[model samples]
Target chain A: MSGGRDRGPDRGRRRGHSLHAFRAILAKDLRVELRTLQSVPAMALFGVTTFVLFRYGLDRTKLSGGLAAGVLLATVLFAAILAINRLFVAERDEGGFDAIRLAPVDGTALGGAKAAALIVYLVVLEAITLPVFALFFLDSWAGLAPVAGVLALADVGLAATGVLVSAIAANSRARDLLVPLVLLPLLIPVMIAAANAAEPLLAAQGPAYGGIGKWVGVLALYDMTFIAVGFAVYDFLLED
Target chain B: MKVPSLRALSIATILCLGAGFTLVFFYAPLDADQGFVQKIFYLHVPLAICSLAGFMIAGVHAIRHLRSGDPVHDARSYVSIHLSVIFGVGVLLTGSIWAHASWGRWWVWDEPTLVSFLIVFLLYATYYPLRYAIEDRDRQARYASVFAITAGAFVPLNFLAVRMAQSLVHPRVFATTSGGLPGSMLFTFLVCLAGMALLWTCLVCFELAAKSASAKLSRLRRALEGETYAAPNRSRIAPSVPSRAASPLT
Candidate 1:
């Protein structure tokens, strides 16, 4: 970080640096993740564990309709925290993050690629969990759609934030515990959408004239707001 | 960038307090709904708006830092955010007390007002940890700026999201429910907003003065440390900084 020489040419080299940097980071995370497949399995395990808990405690015998929405939202939220914690920490433990930062590159684009990989992993984790959640807890697909949209958009905000926090966690004590301490409080926006959207949809209320639209709007606003914030901050977090 | 003198700010504080209290106690009419409890609106809304405004200033300075690579601007922006977090808590405590008075509940998730304050509380709470977890000064400033800006958007959106949800636990007949208001309430609200902004301007100047003084103190201390500390001209940074203490908040 301290020793690099600043060369004369400004225009061409900087562009090439950005492109190369993005690809390098993307490839590195992908290869490491593909070989070990750590995030997916740990996330899947978390999803399964949540489902098992839901199934064991309230699997129809003890459950009521009013509590269904609240329970499902809690389920997705638990999966999210597990997935985020697993996905971010492993990148540093494997030295993938250090390589990306040490490389001469556009840190934001590198951050962009990391976000992309994270989103892909998250989507797959969600997929694995969806059937499990649907089979055990939720009634149908309608509720899952809005809830999924909320999770997806929230995923970007979380993962973009994950990049910043992951960097901080790397240099801190017990990075694992620190991630959630910093990350969970930021979940207020997510909590509102997931809980609200889940309740109406689980009751099969999606057919209303424009009911789901409001929840969708909430999710979209969260996405747009955080994406802009992430872009502005990514470069700074990468200054090494 | 303009700063009111400390004496002037002190005078302004006295005037705003006198006007705010007089208006609330005597001039403002009792609400058709929540009664005098609604008067809490005079304090809660203005504090929330001011804190949000502070966060926005931090975001703007973050832009300057990212664009021009100016650490001083980064420091100034962080100072604004620091005050914002403190004021944001003031907003939360007032809102919570108002909720207890009006709704007969200390905390409820569905009330947009309660939910909004919780969001403000939680988001700003994250700022300190984010600052403390990092070893890099510039990185802390930058990430905290991103957080400060995101907070600007998140605060309002969270308010809206909680409101849009079905079966709200807290309902208010405040101006937000209806677009505009009676002339007097609107006038009172505007005066409060302007007063709070002025208060923030004064706070920022004070913080900057303290920060500059502290920076000078650190430099002087290092200079006196002599052979133990490297000279500033030749030292680009405190290289390989270990056992160094960082601020709890960025």
Candidate 2:
């Protein structure tokens, strides 16, 4: 009776894909990470350096650099592109993608792991970029709070969307050029939101970029919309 | 398999196109504000809306193809979206000219209608590169269909995003929040919208015929190639798309 139940389609669950399969994918990716340890450090170094250049580029320093914060989400986003551009390349290059697809892994689960890994990678970079900018330019406590929140939210959306694109690029020819070209245009809106919302915070002006309520709502909407899309579409993308 | 004829459609299109313009010139009262040139709104706004509708149809077919995996639906959808791009180009041109005429500038960074179309233009322009990159017939269809479906998000997101970015310069004369258009203007606007929509249908049907024919021709050509497919072509055709066609435009 136990064997029959365990082997049943119902017990197998949802077209034979299992949560264990999802967990296995997460574990597989982590094991791979433990072996290489290359991507995270490269992404972190690139993200930190890019953030510093922008904050340092400003002349008048304090107030001016603050104003630049909201707008320079584009720069951080470019750093994201650089970091994750090779995301699925390793899977394709080593011919491991096929084995993974054949491993009973749900596409969403696999995408979730990669996205989780990328977010972890990007957040480390952000951990470097944001603090360096904070010590150098961001001074006020009130301003710092919202700016940090918005930036964190913006990075999630960027990474999720970027991961899907990176998959498409990795599969195609002239992949390196293709990824960034497609990515940067899509990144423009998030850059707009991040910049506009963070502007007042940077400048210590009244937070009136459509009010904090409207501004953060846009970022949240963007995050939910893209993450859902990335998860659903990643299956089709990853299925060879 | 079957599509409706364009006969009555085009006749109605021509008649209404004439009638729509006539009302714009003769019937609608002059604005209490901008005088003669304001009449361009009758033509400009409807055309933009018509193109937006075209984009929406393309997006719908894109989703249908992705879900159902039917090549026929994919062809139809690709046709609808292709026509949308053609119509969208027209919208940008006419609207920009009118903008230049009124505002003394060809482009405004803060205009909702203008910038929104710019984003749409950029988005659809990439559609070609997307098509060229993938080799699978059905996968190409699937990817394109999904991209098109996802584009609906861009239309609204761009519109809303642009509005949030700055104080919009484009007039909201038609917006209900701005008290709506006067009755005569409203009537002319609706007629114009109907006329443009009819014209769009005709164009989409035309392009649908062209695409379906082209696809059949390519399949027939491949079949004619007969032996070996040059040996390399068979495997190459399965996955690696023609590299040049797939490159990003910049």
Top model number, TM-score: 2
Residue-wise lDDT of candidate 2 within A25-49, one digit each (tens)? 5676667766987666676566666
Docking class for model 2 is acceptable
| Per-residue accuracy of model 1 over A1-240 as CA lDDT, tens digit each | 233455445545876888887787778778888999877778778777876786667656233233665665566566666656655565567766576677667667767777778787878887788667667655456656655665677677667666655655655544677677766666666766655655555664442223656666677677776667677666666565
| TM, every model | 0.80, 0.84
lDDT string, candidate 2, B109-154, tens digits: 7687688787777777776677677766656666666666656666
lDDT of 2 at B121: 76
Model 2 interface RMSD, in angstroms? 1.9
lDDT of 1: 0.66
Question: Candidate 1 at residue B208, lDDT?
Answer: 63
- Score chain B of candidate 2 by TM-score: 0.81
Candidate 1 lDDT for residue A198:
52
Task: State the lDDT of candidate 1 residue by residue for B70-172, as single tens digits.
Answer: 6666666676777888888788788888878877877766666666666667767766666666566665555566566656666677677767763656544
| TM-score of candidate 1 to 2 decimals | 0.80
